[model samples]
Target: MGNSSSLHLQQEDVQAIQDETGFTPQQIERLYSRFSSLDKAGKSHLTREDFLRIPELAINPLGDRIVHAFFYESKNGEEDKVDFKDFVRVLAHFRPIKKNQEKNKLNTRMEKLHFAFRMYDIDGDDKISKEELLAVLTMMVGQNICPEQLLSIAERTIIEADTDRDNLISFEEFAKVLERTDVEQKMSIRFLS
Candidate 1:
């Protein structure tokens, strides 16, 4: 542990999480192990770099957006880091449960989508503009893409996502973009055995 203070999860905290999330002790321990692995310093905070280094996330299609959301969704200004509580909250969206809780799943998906939208919104305008969308894509693509090609891609994405055609993606529009069953299937996370 880099700093003792950074690691704040007590037994009570574990029990609390179990009580709230209905995760078994084994599952909670698995989550804790993951947190510990990412918290190399044992620091409670998981930085953006730490998140990006995860092999699974690095290859995930929505990895960048999810990383962005992880930071942006922090109640406290986690800045570039997420504490354990926030981490758990984020993971709640992806619990590997066989028994379908349709309402919970839908709500979690919406929350995740909203976080992603905020990540793409750039200026905190509660809406995604073409420029912002382009910037995010550019960040994701780096120097590999030409400006014109990026612009065209952004325009197409906006057109596809902007159902009402207001040229901006509101939460509703963003939800429509991400709400497909296929997308949900792809985004779903499988918990560690």
Candidate 2:
């Protein structure tokens, strides 16, 4: 039905990639010489071996397209040598745009994190404390609750939501954690109220 199959990231895999991209995982993972594959770890990263693996193929976009074309041909009992140089050119074209998009994505992530800290700094303290955590957790839990539940809830809220090691939960960390669990249309109303 289709010329080629596409590899999609699972929800957990997507989260891992996003988190890794946010932190140092992407670079660190590569050092182990393990590859990041579309399906898992089967396909290795681009190195001399992978580059040379394709005999006649170039490592650019045209090459990439040609490879796919060749693959389709092969699957149907046909074979052709793809130009490696042209494939390299295709990859070169994609490189710049990919880098730009990644940068934009990183910037957007930072902005959201910055905004969360701003909103939670109700007293302009620049640091979220136990009291602040309690106040918000109380609201999310509702107005009428017991003291014991409140204490446990308050503690859990701060412990689970706090991401950075500063003993305070920054807005960005909280937002990221919440994002993993739930999505609200008006996050501001919930946070502000």
Candidate 3:
């Protein structure tokens, strides 16, 4: 198992991750070191518990959803764990879209929106229902607002964004609502080189 982890950190594999994730070699190495430290079992993969154990994430309002997004790409019945490659790939969605960045599909505005959409589309359905939006809103601001106010806010949000009047916010509707907002800048994170 230890050998497998080292294999992924090899030069060739690191290059592949860099290509797919738009992470610099240095960034990949740094993230891999963090991943290693988080993988107390040294299995080259992280479990939900490992992610939840992070002190910052423990108190983050969106922490659970962020953690869920990391495992969203899991396949072959490994839904509970995220390998190093997938971990980096998920993080790639937050890479700032530089004016001269290469054509990295993963870092596009659409991809970033989709990542945010998935947080509200908790059921994995292609649309965000009122209940779904309410659930997310509660997660974010439930502590400050009462239940009635939260539900009202969620309903208003859905009504405003549901352009087709379908009572649910589709991806197109969600995108349209955010059309004026600078998703590129808002979704990006500065990755240390």
Q: lDDT of each structure?
A: 0.73, 0.41, 0.86
* Higher-ranked by TM-score: 1 or 3: 3
Residue pairs with backbone atoms closer than 3 Å in model 1 (clashes): 1-41, 2-41, 6-44
After superposition, which runs of candidate 1 have C-alpha atoms over 4 Å from their true positions?
A: 1-12, 19-22, 52-64, 76-80, 96-99, 102-107, 139-146, 163-165
Candidate 2 backbone clash number: 16
Query: Could you give candidate 2's per-residue lDDT for residues 89-127 as a string of tens digits?
Result: 222221222233443332343443443454445455666
Model 3, 34-109: lDDT tens per residue?
8888999998789999999989889999899999998996542589889988888888898887787794778888
Q: What ranges in model 3 sit over 4 Å off?
A: 1-8, 75-77
lDDT of 2 at 104: 31
Model 2: residues with Cα > 4 Å off, grouped in runs: 1-119, 139-143, 181-193
TM-score versus the correct structure, for each prediction = 0.71, 0.33, 0.92
TM-score of 2: 0.33
Model number with the top TM-score:
3
Candidates 1 and 3, the one with greater lDDT: 3
What is the model-wide C-alpha lDDT for candidate 1? 0.73
